[model samples]
Target: MELQKGAFYLIEDIDPEKIFTAEDFSDEQRMIESMVADFTQNEIIPNLEEIDHQKEGLSRSLLAKAGELGLLSADVPEEYEGGEMGKISSAIITENISAGGSFSVSFSAHTGIGSLPIVLFGTEEQKKRYLPDLATGRKIAAYALTEPMAGSDALAAKTKAVLTEDGKYYVLNGEKIFITNASFADVFVVYAKIDGEKFTAFIVDRDTPGFSIGPEEKKLGIKGSSTCSLIFEDAKVPVENLLGEIGKGHVIAFNILNIGRYKLGLGSVGLSKSAISYATKYALERQQFGIPIAKFGMIQNKLAQMAAKTYASESLIYRLVGNIEEALHGKVDGREIGAAIEEYAVECSISKVHCSESLAYVTDEAVQIYGGYGYTQEFPAERMYRDARINRIFEGTNEVNRLIIPATLLRLGMKGQLPLLQAAQDLAGQLISLQVKTSSGGEVPLEVEFDMLNRAKKLFLLIGGTAAQKYMKKLAKEQEIIEIMANMCIEIYAMESALLRAKKALAKDAASAETKIELAMAYIYDAFPKLENWAKQAIAYMFESNEEVRTNLSIAKRLSKYQPINIIDIRQKIAKKVLEAGKYVV
Candidate 1:
């Protein structure tokens, strides 16, 4: 059951039987999920306003309660007074807790970037000292990485940590802006350059003299989460507190970021589901022209799209989690887990980009469904809209993640891990012969959709492979083309995940799984034209010679073309399901 390190597999290597879908949850998982749901409704929702206002001691109190309930320890080792639950269990906890509005951001940062650096990089002594308190929520955690000067170019941080002549302590001096949980965190995973050149990570306690928290920053949303600047003026951190190897902090930083990215995706899905529920309930209760707004076709469109997007997000997030868990199976060492995560860097970026964008889309539609009231501070839709905006920006901006997707794909291609070049050559041969290869999934439903998905993958290869050959080591400068390739990959992954889940559902109950099928179909149909448009843009950028443009355009048209579905009817059916359940059904 353990995955071998240094082994990479292509999509063809994946077994359909082993692919985990949302419905694969065990009763035990469901119980934990229900516990989180109850806690969110009873504990978090009631205290929303207080949390939003940054009430003194309130977030910590709630976090302590979460710790008491063992909510904060899912990923920690059992020996560290933790749950030692697998990735799936931890992911479910994160997804359920995301319904808590701004509080979820605080929770995510604390568990993810805040504590994971230690969990995945700390020495035995460090873990023994910090993991127990963090697992029990006796001490709050925060991540300090973003500096005033170092935003996207994280390595350009001006913060410096110099070891004393005796080498017993590192005298750190720097300021980190936008440190989540800054106002209340008792411990920080601080990143700085050692001796002014080597990037490193240090565990700095809040009570350390000369370490101070600046005033909280006002924000667009997620106001309940503490955000402040961390000022370190010659703060002395014990040399033993350095995490991982010196000059290898990027190992801890990047791997922990991958964890944050995927978890952010899951949390986005949770928020999307919550937004759909809020919008649907509002639509059902609010009347327009003496009838519930849910009866209106226009309103139905938004509701259906929101539900479909949420379904897609949920499917992909869970599927990705399953992969990560399988990859890390039987591996408990911090470095091993980090390497396993780093192996799926491309998939992590895809999930982060797709799910966050999906949430943004759903929340926007949720606001639109609420009409004028949605624009006001009094409505939940407005808050959801504002809160959802940050997902696309944080954990790495979607733009940065988009770039990472294609870059990672190309890197994998160069390493012979993805068969990208071979696939592209095959695709080109087929295109020249006018022979189209369709997906073959025996006895599977939605064969046409799956076939289209196959073609989409080919289109991604055709465009991406051509771009790579044409640019030839200079493609990094072609940001737009990279973005297009990334978009194709994102859509391909989303469509695949949704299709696989729907196929699984159909196998279990063909008639009852209608909604799942519709959602999958809707996502594919919606993505087709967008993918084509992206292709057109990429093609335009790739070639200036008329013959080259014409030839590629023809190939793009053929690969991107698909028969459109009666999406309006599907939406009506889907919206009916949402309206009936008063939430996202899938």
Candidate 2:
């Protein structure tokens, strides 16, 4: 299985000369994005209050309307009465529709985890039977994996499925909790242990006997989306309804989860942008101290921080989407597609962690900027704050996703995919020489920032590679070290992504991309200190010997070196632009 080529597989693999930005959206993608925006404003936003009230069937009804516009089938294959639109198309749809508040959860779940399992792992017969209705959203779909006993440890599910003596059906008896879209889904992709041992996936219809949904859960946010428990009281399902291979349900569960994590990140980006727009508008309209609050430095700070992080998150999300779309292109088989997406599992986890946290921060700042009105239900920030909380908790908690990042990194290194060992050895040699090359005059704009990013990548390789060598297999047990690596990776990826996007803009027309350059500079300058601190902490904790610590710290300080810029001023500049536009300026 050859891993598909992409923009970059590792931090060191980033090409300072190469650029990939979201600005290059295709005409079709833009059209789809515009259509989704229109639908979100017309069909979803006005009814947000009613949907959040859980007006019976309101969420599903809006999904049906979206489906009527073929919004739900963007990623489904054309052969299955689906659109077969590219991944970015679907990502844009998800991004635009995310402004609809809680309905975004329902829509994303239905289109992503709900239907994609069948799209990627289902049998031909299964696709023929289910994809049509799911594609059209005539019958909503739900994924049931989390159980009362199993949330993060999904395979620890107590759900049991046994084949009957008639050689026909599997009697499934278990309960799945906190299931999205459970209230009105027509089909469910459920996970259970076969004969109380092998984990397997099954496609069960909502009308299956003994299949019942528990009452809707009262939630902190996204109240408009359906959440309930699914009870399988000896639910009899046909043998052919099984999805993927028996005893291999983890494949489906994890691959679908990878897709879910990144899509959730994209949703976070959209939500953060919405929050910034709301906050900026509020600041402009709500005057304080005989002037608009937008004039205040503190308010400007909050707005700038929100836009900066949103800019970084958006850059990275679309970059990953482009990578996945390229990898999955021309692949017809489900397993092949799954393999393609799994190659970038590390990036997927990074997107999930970084973007979700960005959204959380953005929403918190939005609430802060809105002041008293922000806390009240009268303003959108109140709901934004609530809805954003769940991103950090779900799609694998940020903690869990953080652990996955370093684990996947090590796996890729061991597989010779990332060349970490070689990079570390080379950096160690260079450290002895103390001869790091700095950018010269006549370099491209922001070349110094790019050089600093490259050094940061080397810093990561130095620390992470050394940790891997020292801890060996025991690194898995060192959660703290793993988290440090994850944070370092997150910062590096976000900074580089913004840089690449900004450079792409410069490549197009440097004169008009000043904001893009500012976004990159502000993000990189803000991100460097965090990466430096994380590197120092990891080195301090992992290196017990004093000489080793001193040497590594010296090398780290050298590699992490950068000429400081006034991020506050750049941020103020960014804030002024955001305020002028009344949204995320980037």
Candidate 3:
């Protein structure tokens, strides 16, 4: 695949900062997260083998235990016997519980995509009848949206839902594949075609005639979570079972997937951190040639990169979560939730792509760090590596997510956010000031750096502007590349934004002088070289054949005045803090 200059440039300028301090979490949120983590460590970890090996179904006893702790109720409303913790807190709980192997998939599905539809779109009677039981894990909920013919093209569902002549019920006939909780679900939110033209969602009970599950398919990972196909052979569903307005199933499906994407990212972040910790611990203890493997330069480089990427993922996910919270501060009704969530499609998609891909990189390196043992089932890295692979594929594949990010941004651009253009201007100004301060060095031509940065900025603006104009109306069709670019830009912007915030915080805090100084130095030391390289590469690729642009790349490379510090040492300091905190802190 050809590199998109705009996307590559965005990836190049990532800066490190303490944007996500632990202070952002509420005491209750932290407490719940701790409770979930403890539950996973104490209750679930010891029984992973049983859950993984049990063929009859999920361990009923374990599900009951989780329900007792209220782990299954975070997303449901309090009136329905749920915690009503909102997405951020629910995400924290999901992420922490993910440490319990395949059971996390079961837990997240029960709380998120499976039950969110009823809470958001079901009628009052529907909520009363189902939420209480679903929340308490007395019943399991499943969402059936993807069919054999409609995986990525989900709206093209062929399943039929025909209304009875007297309008008493709908006769549903469809098969949904790869449902997470299908084998054990008591209630299912199923979507099917209506009158050959419209799609609608229905809540079908497991006891309904013709509602049956296919044999569980052996899967690549998440073995403990039941995976099967749901078959509805002329299943009779009451009119009251319709999730929302007829033909509005698309709204529920898409919006729920958006939330699912964010939750998936959050879970991936936790797993990535776990992978890093396992690798680092192994590196510190395992010796080669009479010394610890971590003492080797290449091994240290891998560790540093994993830590840096994990930090970046941590910073981005929490920031996105905060944005969502701010967007939905006073809104409580389900009608308002859709619009509120639609506001964050871009950020949610970016977070999904960033965290998932980061975990892929981190986990792969973790296995490498463990050498041969990492590839064995005896070690956790092997399982983590396998489980981590699904994040990028499911929950709207990363390829699909790439499209959503940029397309949403472009659509927003037409509405005047125009993030790429604004960000480019800000970056150009920063480059100009950096140039002016270093003009006296004469080591590299300042004019060349200015020319390269400006050209690269212009190219980014041009591509973004073109996409916005062309796909302003058909946002979904062109969402893939648009998402890829948007994700890249958000990461770059976030890194720079965090650096600025950290710089200001350091300047104001007198008591944190020593710590602040190290953070500030680390940001500059790590960010500048990468930013310069990114600008140069972006410019070179955009105008490679143009002599004027091609000739300026050498000048951009030589402009850096600061010497390269040992990034390994800097990252070790960061990793130590992360380890001590038992999570990414700052």
Using all chains and alpha carbons, the TM-scores for the candidates as numbered come to 0.96, 0.97, 0.83
Q: Model 3 — TM-score against the truth?
A: 0.83
lDDT of 1 by residue, 1-586 (tens): 3342221223343434566877888999999999999999999999988989989998889999999999999989989999887899899999999999889999999988999898888999999999999999999899999998788678888899999999899999999999999999999999999989999999999988889999988999999999999999999999999999999888888898889999999999999999999999999999988999989999999988888887888887888888889988888687788878988888788889899999999989888988999999898888888899999888789999988887787787898866777777777677765544344343556887876877777788788889888896898888988888888888888888888889878878888778899998887788878988888888887789989999989988888777666899999999999899998996
**C-alpha lDDT (0 to 100) for residue 404 of candidate 3:** 65
RMSD of each: 2.2, 2.0, 6.2
| Stretches of model 3 off by over 4 angstroms after superposition | 1-21, 55-57, 416-459, 466-484, 493-566, 575-586
Indicate whether candidate 1 or candidate 3 has the larger TM-score. Answer: 1
Q: Predict model 3's lDDT versus the native.
A: 0.70
* Cα error of candidate 3 at position 382, Å: 0.7
Estimate the lDDT of model 1: 0.86
The lDDT per prediction is 0.86, 0.88, 0.70
Evaluated at residue 521, the lDDT of candidate 2 is 88
The global Cα lDDT (0 to 1) of model 2 is 0.88
Predicted candidate 3 versus true structure: per-residue lDDT over 1-586, tens digit per residue: 1111122333243222423333357899899888988998898888887777754655556776888888888878899898888767877887788788788888888788999999888888999999999888899888888889888778888899989999988898888999988888888989988886788888999999878899887877788888899888988888889888888888888889988888888888888878877887787789999998877778766766676666556656766665566666678676688777777776677778878888999899989989899999899889888888889887888877776666655555455644554654454355445432333354432223233333334434544544444455664565443543454355454344334334434555644433333343354455445545544554554453677465545434544444445655776676555445544345
Q: Which ten residues in a row have the lowest lDDT in candidate 2?
A: 1-10
Descending-TM-score candidate ranking: 2, 1, 3
Q: What is the number of backbone collisions in each predicted candidate, taken in the order shown? A: 0, 0, 8
Residue 361's lDDT within candidate 3 is 93
Q: Candidate 2, 199: how far from true, in Å?
A: 1.1
Q: For this target, which candidate reaches the highest lDDT against the unseen true structure?
A: 2
